[model samples]
Target chain A: MTTALTVETDPAQLCCEPSSQPVLNAVDAQESARVLKALSDPNRLRLLSIVKAGDGGEACVCDLTEPLDLGQPTVSHHLKILVDAGLLEREKRGTWAYYSLVPGALEAASARILGL
Target chain B: MTTALTVETDPAQLCCEPSSQPVLNAVDAQESARVLKALSDPNRLRLLSIVKAGDGGEACVCDLTEPLDLGQPTVSHHLKILVDAGLLEREKRGTWAYYSLVPGALEAASARILGL
Candidate 1:
């Protein structure tokens, strides 16, 4: 039952009883979609990938800018969006701000498509 | 080294060699972001959820609209987006169109945040 058949070639069958698995409610969908929307931008995902691939799973805006080939302000803007979506944590140290992936953020996003 | 510090309490430390893991490139990011963006709408995620939670892991627009309280056209629009994003496969039979989740689409997305 883990695999579902394509309805094109076969008749529709109910593999499980009706309402067996709970569905996502409107509120949950809204919250999850908000977080996902923040991550929809290519620049943002790249920034996230860089931070995740960084040593200690963290990176500063300055570190990302060189390889990102983007201005410091642009990188900071992306970081801000990620932080707002709770996907990244931001901290300032003297002069530079660093970013790290928030625990469970990615997993939560992944869980959605699995009907979580 | 999997857990990263908040940087508020500790000095930065590089836990691994530089550029140890491959990161997402611009092209990959763009492609991935497009899929995630399509999934970013609340109504769309809800529609996906109902389809995913279906007994055979598939659903027709008629099957979704009652619980969703959405008009048929509205539900169909959402489904079209999912299909276009390659998250769902659509097939027409007589009149109704049935949909099933595309394999590995969700995993590919989840893998991105993990720097895959």
Candidate 2:
């Protein structure tokens, strides 16, 4: 014969289990944060906007300076950061450099957060 | 009689027009950057992932610390930042605190980037 009793339970099991579902690993989190950190600036965002709206789907560095009221050097610095983050591509066209959004980068960024 | 001129254009007009389609305004950019800044930390991103995957869409503060290998105070600080950024909501049950993702905030954050 067997008897069952339910007067109490183990104290440890009362605590909720941490979800087994995949969470962001440290390496991926670091990488995603780096990209996001690059985008967490107002000027950088404005630069992306200007480049995105530029004629022929690209904008010369000269055109970017005037709109943001930033110096050419300052705008260039911001653009370089965006370029490094893989969100923008830079091209040299004779005397001036042009910048344009990397195709699908914005969508990829959006997906990063949603997929997380 | 009027003569049509096509040989050259005015010097100012040669530069592309800054986007007439309205880029992110300063206020909105500042606001969005704050939220993204909150997310730009590796620990914070992991915190969000764990909470999102927690049972019944909620998790206790006690459960969060071990998975991230962070101290309770450190985890609390990160949770506070996420809460302040409008990404998570906190509720108190007895002596412990519970956190859940703020509905639609991730979508809104993604929208902020795409809309920009």
Estimate, for each residue in B27-105, the C-alpha lDDT of model 2 and write its tens digit.
7888988888888899998989888888878888878888878897999899999999999999998767899999999
TM-score for chain B of each model, two decimals: 0.73, 0.82
Question: Can you write out model 1's per-residue Cα lDDT over A1-116, one digit (the tens) per residue?
Answer: 32444654343343222343228888998998988898899888888888887768788665777666778789888889999999999888766677898988887777765554
C-alpha lDDT score of every prediction, in listed order: 0.74, 0.81
Clashing pairs in 2: none
Decoy 1 TM-score against native: 0.77
Winner by lDDT: 2
Candidate 2 per-residue lDDT over residues A23-75, each given as its tens digit:
89989899889888888888888777777777777887767777678787898
Which digits, one per residue and each the tens of the lDDT, describe model 1 over residues B1-116? 43444554343333223343338888998998998898899888877777777758787654666676778788888888888998889877665677778877777766665553
Best by TM-score: 2
The TM-score that candidate 2 achieves is: 0.84
Interface RMSD values for the candidates, listed in order? Answer: 5.4, 2.5
- Measured against the true structure, the TM-scores of the candidates, in listed sequence, are 0.77, 0.84
